[model samples]
Target: MKLELLITRDAWQTQVAVLEDGLLVEFQQEPRHLDGLVGNLYLGRVSRVLPGMESAFVDVGLDRDGFLYEGDMGPLPDLADADGIEGKFRNPSIRDLKEGSGILVQVTKEPMGAKGARLSTQISLPGSYVIYLPFMEHVGVSRKISGGERARLKEIVRRLKARVSGGFIIRTAAEGVAEEDLALEMQGLLDQWALIRLRGQRAEPPAVLHQEADLVARLIREVLLRADGEVLTDDAEAAEQARDLLSSMGHPREKVHLWPGKPGSLFEHFRIQEEIDKALRARVWLRSGGCIVIQSTEALVAIDVNSGRFTGKRSLEETAFAINMEAVDEIVRQIRLRGLGGILVIDFIDMTKKAHREALFARLREALERDRAKSRILNISEFGLVEMTRKRSRRNLERVMTGVCPCCEGRGRLPAPWRTAQMIAETLSGRHAPKKAVVTASQEVVRFIEENRDRYAFPSGISFEAAETPRLSHFTIRPAS
Candidate 1:
């Protein structure tokens, strides 16, 4: 499988589109000014503690207060019991985190809509091979690294961790790495944490102690750890920076390539703009004439699958199974590409056979396994519906690309022009009739009102004069003296 990271930088924003085999799989948009806040470390002060919610609101110098859950406070036993307290509950109450208490925290989730960012006090700094945990004192291997390799790597970390001052979670990239290299990476993370700790101590509350790397560097370090094909960038400076970063880390700098396209943008040359436009639409069509309608609301996302025009050569059961299976692939791709999160309920073409439902459910899970964001899938229900939730760090692609409709005010529909005219007529009739009433609206609506003036039952004392305006379904009535 060939994978490419296509980077596009403009004055407005920098976009990273992950393409697998020339198909857009994942896309991220980062504005030039405000980068994402997921991994930022802050010295925060507790603003309020809600005992009922088991969470505390912390002032982290953002527009909204960061949310600190009870679980994120870390193990209380490790805080107190490690020093000899016994039988004490490990989870402390939120009330214990009183207002004005300063604490070190890192953003785990980005702020979305009205909610603030999610924070954790169990600070962790991530490196290429290891994630440093300052407060803990053990080594853990990534679950993805299995068999004897996991045991071997864990032993290596255990032996080398004594040289460092903190715990380390061996990342997936460390599966076959040398012990010396792993130790070096662990020490780098520890050094970073030490600096962050010093900054946190000296900095005032609600100050940023550490900021994450930029998008290009971070993509190389975190996501595109093994660039199977190449990382293509339109900007020369960005390409050079990526090459330098990879070269400094001893990775292959040859994988970072500059796009050769001239006159036209890289995304335009790759035809990515067409795919992006398709992603923003509500309906998606599959190769076999099946379709999926994805609708998003404030609460959750609902997807309905349909076998549009493709009639199979076989039985009804076979056709339903085939179309449902196809829908699963597209649904998973859409969820990842669009960054859909929160509660997602998918309505598949109802299948009667229990085995078929199980097969589809399993396929859904396997397809979503490639997704980097954490997600959980529930078993297919008797009603042939599957429910799931993907972890949401920042706003989804749709929310970021588009805003609430101005005319409809996000209702997705506007009032009819005739209805608006009637309301205008009613308001004018209720008031003391003037010699002339001026009605302002769009050209079409004004013509409609003028042609249907007799039907409106407007008072004879008022003569209606239509004034053209650009509004679709809006108008105003005023007396013309």
Candidate 2:
């Protein structure tokens, strides 16, 4: 499969599109004003420690305090280990932290809605080939790399572990990487961590010690390097940066291609914007005429599949199976493209046969294997429902691209004209009703009242006036001059 990375950067924002086999599968955009906070390291001051909740709030110099849970405090030294008899490690309790105490923490999840940033004391610095765990003792390899390659990478890390002070998780990209390259990257991460620690020691509490790389550099390191893809960008500065990064990483600088098209045209030429618009909508139509409707709430995301128009030339069971199999592919694609996370419940078409249900579940799990986000999917139930949870570090695409409807206040529904009329009638019938009242409302509401004058007992002293208002459900009533 061929992979391509297209980047568009302007003064407003930077958009990155990852295409697999010339089809968009993942999209990300970072606005200039709103820099992402995840992966940042900070020397935070403990503002409050709630022993009852086993958590603490840390002031990280952000708009909101970062949350620190007990589990994220890493393996604390066990009291029983005072004698150094190889005692087991224990998780630190929230009571161990005092108010106004300073701690070094890293942001694991960005702030979403009312929640502050999720933080952890276990800091892990990621590189192109490995993730350096400065405090962890475990040296692991990516589960994707197996057989001799996995063993080889593990052995390489173990051999070099004696020289370094931290653990390493060899990434899939390190499967065929040489020992020298791994050693170099490992040392670089160690040096980086050393500097972060040094800076944290000297900095005051609630100070930022390290900030994560910008979106373009992050995607290049995390995505482009793993896929060995060509990077296309219209911005000369970004193109030059990509070339320099690739060259430093021992890759060909030519992989960073400077597109001749005008700024923002690269996405249009590849029809990426069309895909993005489709992702924003609730319903996504499959090639087979089947569709999936995705709805997100505060708690979880719900996906429902419907076999719209395609009536397969087979038995009912076969038809259901065909549509469901196709739905699985699109569902996985949508999940990645939209950057959906948190709990997801999928309501597939009910399949009676156990064999068919198992096959569908297996296909879905396989398709989601390519997703970078870590997810756990359960087996499909008898009612053809699948429940899964994906790790979320940042806001999803819809939340990033759209805002709550001001008129509906995110309810996705508006007050009916009849409802508005009823409110108007109630106001007019009050004992203190104005002797001469001028009511202003939306055109729809005003037309409803004018057309249905007999339905409502509006006082003769009251008159209705139409005004174009952005808030459809809003209206005003004032004493007429």
Task: Give the number of the best model, judged by TM-score.
Answer: 2
Model 1: worst 10 consecutive residues (lDDT sum)? 78-87
Across residues 1-481, which tens digit of lDDT does each residue of candidate 1 receive? 6888899898878888888777788888788997778889888889998889999999999999999998887633222123221213334567667699776788988887789999987778888788887767778887678999999899988988775555888877677788888878877776786676567556778899889887777777766763345799889888999898877666798988888887238989888878888999999999999899999998999999998997988988899999999888789889989989889999999889888988998899888876777899899888888999898876788877888787787888778878888777777766465647666677667788778877887666555445654457777667766
Q: Residue 86 in model 2: shift from native, Å?
A: 16
Query: Residue 78 of model 2: what lDDT?
Result: 25
Question: CA shift at 237, candidate 1, in angstroms?
Answer: 1.9
Task: List clashing residue pairs in candidate 1.
Answer: none
Candidate 2's displacement at residue 296, Å, is 0.2
Model 1 bad stretches (over 4 Å): 75-92, 163-166, 431-435, 443-455, 461-471
For model 1, give the RMSD to the true fold: 3.5
The count of backbone overlaps in candidate 2 is: 0
lDDT of candidates 1 onward, in order: 0.80, 0.87
User: Which ranges of candidate 2 are over 4 A from the true structure?
Assistant: 33-35, 75-91
